[model samples]
Target chain A: MWLRSHRPAAALMKKSEGTRRDFLRACIAGAAVLGTGGSMELLEAAEQSSALVKSRVVIARDPMLRGAGTTVDSKRALNLLDHAMQALFDADHPADPWKNLVRPGDRVGLKVNALGGHAFSSNLQLVEAVCERLQEAGVKANDIVVWDRDTEELERAGFHISSAPNHVQCFGTDRTGYEEDLVTYGSVGSRLSKILTRSCNVLINMPLLKDHDGAGVSMALKNMYGVIHNPNKYHPNGCNPYIADVNMLPDIRTKMRLTICDATTAMYEGGPAYKPQYSWKNNALMVSRDPVALDYVGWQAIERKRAEKKLKTLEAEKRAPLYIATAADAQHRLGTNDPRRIAVIEAQAGR
Target chain B: MAREMISLADVKFPDVSPINEIARGAELGPRLLPLDRRSFLKCAVMAGAVCGISAFAEPCAALLPWAGGPTQGDSQFTAEARFYEKLQNKKIKCKLCPRECVVGDRERGYCGVRENRGGTYYTLVHSRVCAAHIDPIEKKPLFHYLPGTLAFSLATAGCNVNCKFCQNWDISQVRPEQIRADYAPPKTVAELAKQNRCPTIAYTYSEPVIFSEYLMDTADAGHEAGVRSVVVSNGYMQTESLKAAYGKMDAVKIDLKAFSESYYRDVVGGELKPVLDSLVTLRKLGKWTEIVYLVVPTLNDSDSEFRGLVRWIKTNLGVDVPVHFTQFHPQYLLKNLPLTPVPTLERAKAMADAEGLHYVYIGNVPGHPAQNTYCPKCRHLLVERVGLTTGQILIRKGSCPFCKQPIPGIWHA
Candidate 1:
């Protein structure tokens, strides 16, 4: 219904010739001044550029966790995380642009989203496995900091409180004015936590896959809200452009090396939380360097879950994955909603 | 012709919450304090107007117009936030808004600030400023506070909302790191505003709610230096944090997007109750509160809605609260729509007047007669205005010169 209302009734405008070059030029120029220009303008351009990069979402079907029975074993989660990471990044360094940025001794900041408790948050086992792999790949454990917005939530999700000196320092930005001095958000001055913006050589975006009440789906880009202190202010007119725009910020996106979304127990509706009745435990993990594409596939999975339950469609709920289109059409980094350019692969767990 | 509904079989998986009895509030770990919506409004309205938080509003105000410029100095932007819980595999949940974002190992929040990294959530825009500006206090449209004075404005990237017709979409609609940012610390912002002779620092442009921490610190500094503060914001806020900050500023301007709940849900993605609650709270706190209602053609400019809004303001906030119905320009995602017609703005002003709002004015249309402030009882122009610059005030000690009806505002001798 939302798409019906918003889908430009007029035929889509043809991509103007040289538009891609113009966008790329703008992006390069925008990136050049990332240190000086206002963060919001950089975000706007990047977001618009990301939206222009049209990509397809692919969900690997044929359940992998179908046979794994009953037991609440933590090891299974680790296996899945390891499987997903290896499948996505492989033994080889990420291709092209990312290949040059990621390396050993890089203080890799593992950006995680724990808005959902145990049911819907990133699996600790997966996080540990991935960190271990990073260490194996030459990144130091002490250099890796697993963080979010609140220490309490971290504890609630069974995260070990890491205040020990020299260990992977784990702390929340919620501690008195932690994000208070950070940059502003648009004309709206938004403060972000210093940990995400000020301290980290490389960032690894890790978000859970879930249906969001406001945005159609919450993915890697949306996970950045934990970087800032006040998110309620941005929840306007469905948080469409702002959420998409905020995700494009250079401080958040530029420092990031990859996006990896967790879809093991995908929440289809009424989520960001685990709804057992409405949840679909596909027990699969998804990883990608492209945040937009990662979320795109997750959105499709959510739509499928809703359909099976006879629940309201994203459109019926007055919400849809409009940001994906926005991210694709943004700076024209991605094509015009075409899946051909997006590489979708399926890999099984290997010994 | 109507189309037939599709079968459910072809549909895909939906994002649904667990119905298990265990999947209640504890799973999300509610950090949001229990405060009534109205109380939250009060906090939003009073933010930065009080002493300690006065510094927070200054940097926000100064950063608005200068978003595209060079970083002033001494601010490095790189780091991540803390606070989140990791689940199985690589999924994480953000504990920031009421919407606890349960993200996989690699994801972000609905606000686009927090992110999931290896099963942990981290903030990404720390100290990254996207926009900055210095303008007259009247530009913030905070008429009731320091009239004719100037303010320093600032903002970063990212908002919680996705208003299709956002004027500042270039900035307010993106993440902090996506944009270029300047390094203007609270002290630098305060010094700059002070150097520019701005008595009050204002946190305007975009939504100040998203940058609470930045605004808070800026407000603190401004107060220490004897500079007053103000905030122009959409009053959607969580009460606990807002109250803690409200005790630090001098004035506030709340953008009442619309009066109807449906309008808020569809067009603003916010609840009307929160805004109304803020206005009432501002009134009770004795803070200088003004409201801006941007009149979008055919969207929020309905006479009935304006009338209802006026009635509510009169009954709840009293007739003293200044209400401005500004004209809207077609931009951003809503360019297909036409600019708000001048007549629509006139009608809105009339509706407010008819509903007994004493200080209703039309904005964004310079040189209009309604632009000047008229005494509620005497009908005398108390303070004149031409765009953002203010003219002579005919009132002495907050009273009209012609009829002596006292005007309510922070007027100087």
Candidate 2:
């Protein structure tokens, strides 16, 4: 029963086989109906009417976008992101969703995951698309910052450091450093990154989808580990409660407005590290307002991929990412992790 | 508004400085005399340096005293670690400490310093000194060894054990890259100790075990330069590595945290048996060892535990071994607890003395009478100490002055 609770329904759907295929077909049909003229306005109206149900996720895929070598097709990736954002906010235009997420005067931070190295990192092309959309949304280029924990990892993952006041800034917490004061939350006591605390008012978590050795999967919630001074202390007991408790911090809970996970290439096993043998091409961009819901979907995607490879499920391996359930617990209530409560709108970009 | 454009080539990294620079600047005194013959001789006499100074008759000007400043950047040194075995899939098991951390590629051990990169283990804090100070040997609380003399104390940025009440948590609980440090090679450390008039180079503040490679190398250099090496540690180390490192040291002071395994697991995040084994090993090796048990109230101050600890020490390490029942102040993560009462320390000391331990003393409370050393044979006071200052040592030629009984310690004749 504990194993069943931790196993995502998507992994369970694989046993039934046709259930997920039928669900995807129904989602595609709904998106097709909404893509018609004037139906976008109806969809926006429906979004407003269903305000009571808050958990929504969008999985936008583009099969042709996977480029050879380490590079991605930037044009196709941008289109995929645009479609994901439009579906996430139920907006008529891509810029409208960005505008709703971040105001023009707000300092926006794009927290990128580069710890997985170049092969399994948040693609640079995806980051560029997000930055471009933010600028189009009327946020000044100078106020947008893309950061990770250190500059070395960012550079290794093909990111250029730019901290000039008049340009789109990119550096790391290593430059700004962590705040001197220690913030205590439950079992967690750490100094927050100044980039998250002082430099940005709005945070866009851009985590890479990968299997984690300790947390079962590194998704939107675990990606916040970069914003703390001591992540090494939280790895015990499968990173449960610690991950959920960290997400509940006021600085993270208030500032994080959206999560756009780069699922272009994911590691279904042996990960948070770049092992080519375990990687697969799952060319998609996942977007959501609820970090817990997005991570739940990402966990399912990893489980599905693992099942395809005939590998054991994370639960079978005794390393299920239980923090997803804890994040949706009564105490934290960060977001909904239940699949039944989440509406995942799946679509193909450039259809 | 028009925005100014800047090219990618023009963008530069912000100047990253070490934290130690700011801390050391406020602490270090003015520069002492240069490393000349007169200064070296004066330092030698003050340090009780009876040997090895004759070899360095000609003072090399290149070997300057520590500038008492921080080192710039994080890429100063990298040494392949000694006690690690390569495992499958580019993983390495660190055999240096009791943790035996099995680290993946590009991932560090629990200590946050030794990393496994491409199937090889490396210590990041090798020669990277984060904190350095000239402290009294009495502060290390080795009352019997070189009383009233100064020790050139230094530490790098990581520790093996995670103690909830760690006083040096800022340095011990962080990775080497997280803090600022200076590159003080083993030779540089020895030269600094000799020039600064410190008889011993103490690897302290943080756990010396995590930086055991640096400690052993510096000890070897200090031996060549006539400076003795000492360690103030938690004693959570593998037997082989512990023997290899502490074998080269003149003395060691181990913090035996408690007598219970559950307290070690819950509070210290370490094992108690390994520490007990290490203490027995130290005694067998005939090292000048001392034990300090900080009596945290309601945590490890029970009479049964104190009697057990004293009985074990008397049986295994002999009754002549010195034990300091130090007071614990609430610190770091354990700040909710009250400061350890002075009476608790006195009670623990009495229990240990009653259990047949010959040299039991109380610490941290200044001007307490138990801070002094007494002869077990004649019941006469051999050494009088207040706080960190030593006054009127009555021992002569490693023996009690009144009873003419030999004491088990490293004493200067």
Candidate 3:
């Protein structure tokens, strides 16, 4: 049989409702199909769990400093870090962003975009602070990894490599590389970073503030592009559906827990790289649990920047980050502007 | 041009003794390629023989020469690209490839490099070079062409489809802005090819079809500077654009990912028909073309399945089109299976041979006898090949010196 011909939901249903006898019988029947080590029990519970219903994305902000420049003092970085984390993982939220969302002893992978080569990238200070906080929140730092596509690019962006205990580790997929592979999203089977999907229990995205040439704006969903092996192939016709399609892949979206876009040094135009002329936006960090909304807001901010420079909007440049809509569609969410469920928290640029 | 002496002294033909005669007889087309000494050499060399045949040299080379250098010039970079039609509301639809990406005002295509700005599609990678290097023509695996020559290889970021098993994923799978790219104009790239002692310039790594304008200009420049051009591509392209592009290239390498249509749909996000169409187009155009079937273990490699593929090639592209069954190492998304076993590769070779396809070879496994060229008539080794270097040639004047059977290839002296 063709690989995709099997029903995905059937496997989950077998795990959820079946008795021990049925489980064993199904296992015998599915052994040939499921290969080795089939787990119907866990699969059933996960399928029935409300957590997978619709993942909530929170963007925490202070609301006071709506505008700021790049490079606030370390103290201000801490403030932004604190507010961002609280906004997403606050205990008071109905969804229980931390307790119910993140379990104890779950490995957290912090995927950062440092490909800008030192100019515009995720603030290492903010990421470090997030890592420290995750450790404090009962997560192990050894289980936490800060990574991107290449170690050289990460190091070039001022990320110190580490693998010791109680400290944030930094590396790219290219360093250890993807030895073992994970299933890509869609019928389009692109390989993802084994580190993010296989090694980690959950993923925390830390994308840089930049304008992508293809996807309009490189935000949370675009940040996940580094997880796959052939991200380059995803950009055929505006990289819309492909970027959306790649993010829709099981290894990326399903495991992504939190996304914090580092608008600290925003690249408003000609980006995903440092255009220099488009650099030095501000010390702004937008944190969110929902990658789609976070990136939608990021796209808004980039268009705002282009407007400030008296330049055209991303749409005028023929590069709106359409993948956000595609992602929302895949997740069965409303349009980007649907006020029924979407929430935005404005914040001060610096502490 | 200085006349150079060429010699063949140690080439060997495959041992056809073990093969069943009936299967072997079916491989040669209805009008079989001449197996005699003089005739076989002409057939072999005929693939890349159009050195000065037509006015479309640069375009032809641009379409299929396989590799080239990255370059840029001081000229104004932006030029309106083809395949886009303007519409109301400042929107446009890119009709270039099968994916007719619609863009409003200022938006790029799915490839990330091409953008529709104010209802005009512009290629961002035009005259831009992301990665450029001198590699063996064998790396492109244009076995039937000038095999041992060096090709100035070049590529820019972005692709038309998303394949999970991409080997050059770091580059081919990213946007132009995501990677580090330098400005290298067509003339500059061609000049670098000359300076680098490369006989051919290849648009490889990333899809050249997306960077059609830049490749066309570069191919023209390369030919002007006395260098050949080749294109290594997925072959998922529109007929008009592909024909126009391949007109300038000297040779073309098409990656026939799989035989199944659904495999292209589910795994590659592309249609198999376009690629197959490209093969037919290339053949009819008389472009020096070769097919590469990446034998992804458990994905595309099946003995009986690949046998059907060999049959298709024999029927469509003719028996002389060198079909390379390259081994797949676990990569990108499909890492569940191990690297294709060498025996599996051998089995595939055996299957293709059984299907009556001539010139079947296994790739990525170095030091295999299939890498060399052989005379069908006498079983004499015509060209001994190791990687990209030619060890020795036992054919003199395009004919096997020992048995005097003509070996098909571009044997110039």
Candidate 4:
């Protein structure tokens, strides 16, 4: 079941047309396979919803998300995010997804990919929209911490560091350092970031959809490298088993609630960094509960773009993102890479 | 032999540092920068790059206070790795060591110092020297080579092998960017050696094998200015790279680690065969070589292993190769293990002596009797050394004055 095609509209109407209870039941089933254990309590807004989708990836898109050059329409980007969240749980309100996922007392960690700097990193507006929605869902503003690998990197990616008690906190693992103890899974043995271990219990994976020279695609599962201390060591062998193994860590597997992949600008080749000549603006945000599925979709999108440009496929180039399949493999079972098991819910928030 | 330097406008430096800058800036070039020439030296001192010379050049180094040093990493101070095969679609296979790491674009090899970028291989730690010192040739434990003279020692970060009991693991096991490194190019290294009154430039601290390009270029620069080059290494290199790199060396000291393959597998994340092959190749190339075996307690300090090591040395590399059975203190991942007893080192030396080895020494334990170099025929002490200090040199014209037997070493500078 490794086909992540665009069957979200049809599958959403067919699979999510049932009661809200079916959504939780399917999520729990998905969780059992992926080793994700959490309380999936229904929210007030989602409780009255007659329809809900299981493993639904709400893809929010808008041409107005990016203006001229690297500047983005932050307000329009937020609207697109809100629309995606509203569509995710098949609920009327934008706050429904966040309310259903997180508790009021939970410390939510927004792990954003600031590796691409200002050019192709996770947009501040999308991160802000997420923080506001979490606050609306009753999680404390102070409890929501946005972080990456380092403070400089976060700043370079256009995020301001804030540790003010009354505001939504933001910083890096460099501020607190990594855990002293090494967490070992498969061939991966590394110290996890204190931001992931000590500062927050709940994690929201906010990554970018970009072409990776080593891993084929940098998306959901690949973004978890930010939580560990030695991401460099795991890059060999196309980061296959390493990426899958890292996600199996207790905190990452169980605590992570959602993945929001910002695909507003992406690279078809020569990436993991912003190669402006090879980059294209797609202006889309992919929101999903399944990290593996989201990454699979991102890979296909990159592959499609590469094909359009008449470049070699990642497999032909010998840099295929096999980590997606490895994650869904029997040993990992983090999420489904199979499109057959995933339903896409497209939210076209046009200007 | 004036070492030249450049300004910021001459090199490419990025805002995000360490990992990203190296990777992203790879296309711009192979991150190569020399040590501060006259123009860049003033600014380098102002930037707080530690004056590498703790010797005669310390005043010139200035030893300025660091402004956190490098804003995290040197923007472009490296060289193109000499030994690597560019694979298809921007991948590369590092031909430097036995671990022919097939690296994808923007990723590094197992050494973490060499990177591949769009089908080009680059050594990120070329002139990026993180550790530097002025040491006696005896400190490098090359007792046979310019015994009383100083060797300008330097190293960049990263090692091909992970030895559990590595003494210099701090610099040896880290990426170049994790530590602070001064941009000292080949010619600059030669000038520093000569300025510090060091006759030899010793590539040491971290594995010099990982920084083969730097060593080779520095060796050339040193030779051009009449300064010699030596290397202290794990000898875990491919024969071609080893010959191509170490061929420029006036002397070499190799850490043989352990004799058995299992010890290499369990304790060192490398193989014993490649290191052994490197030693053979070094010998064939007629390089002045010394072997140091750090005896770790309960790991590689078995009587059988010692007997096997000396016996193998006698069989292959010959007993004439100076063997030093150094006592090891608990270090790195092997900190839980007790120190190697002095008697254990004595026992290993005794075994090497019985195996018909010409010169065997005990190390790390200062003031030991075996620290003195004795004539094999007459048993008269030729060179007396106490740690990094040379006490007496009784070898005249590369021969023991007492026995009149030719002692195998570069006795005169």
Interface RMSD of each: 9.4, 1.4, 6.8, 3.5
Worst 10 residues of 4 chain B by lDDT: B13-22
Cα lDDT, model 3, residue A246:
74
Instruction: Compose the digit string of candidate 4's lDDT tens values, residues A82-177.
Output: 888777766687776666778799999999998777877888888988888899899999999999987888999899899998898899887887
Interface DockQ of each model: 0.05, 0.32, 0.18, 0.18
Superposition TM-score, candidate 2 onto the true structure: 0.83
Tens digit of lDDT per residue, candidate 3, span A1-351? Answer: 011111222433435675775555444434533534543443343334422222334444443333354444555566667665555443343223344335569888889887766666677777777776676567777788889877887899888987776676778887565533345454344657768766787888888767776778887777777887655456555676777777667667567666778776677766554667767546567776666667777777778878888999878777777767776672423123233344666544344
Q: Kindly list the per-residue Cα lDDT of model 2 for residues A229-278, writing each as its tens digit.
A: 77877776678878988887779877887889998888898776788898
lDDT of 1 by residue, A217-315 (tens): 887767886776556555544566666566665576567666667666677876555556657677667766666677666777788778888888898
Per-candidate Cα lDDT values, in order, are 0.61, 0.77, 0.65, 0.75
Candidate 4 lDDT, B24-127, residue by residue in tens: 22222222233224423332332231223223224323322221244224446656788999877677889999989877665678888988766789899877
Q: What is the per-residue lDDT of model 2 for residues B1-413, given as tens digits with 9 covering 90 to 100? A: 11111111112211111111111211222322134554344444422321213222112122334333445455566889999999987888899988777777887777888887889999888888766666668777787799878877778887887788777777788777777666789998898889878889999888889898899999999999999999998999999999999999899999999999988977888999999999999988989999988777788989889988998898888898899987676666888887576678878888887878889987665456787899988999888765555778888999998889998798872
Report the first chain's TM-score for all candidates: 0.75, 0.84, 0.75, 0.86
Candidates in descending DockQ order: 2, 3, 4, 1
Q: Candidates 1 and 2: which is better by DockQ?
A: 2
Error of 3 at A303 (Å): 26
Question: For model 4, what is the error of residue B330's alpha carbon versus the real structure, in angstroms, after optimal superposition?
Answer: 4.0
Per-model TM against the reference: 0.51, 0.83, 0.56, 0.69
Model 2 is docked with a DockQ of 0.32
Q: If both were scored by TM-score, which would come out higher, candidate 2 or candidate 4?
A: 2
**Model 3: residue B125 alpha-carbon error in angstroms:** 0.8
Residues B213-245 of candidate 3 have per-residue lDDT tens digits of: 888889999989999899999998888888888
The DockQ for candidate 4, computed on C-alphas, is 0.18
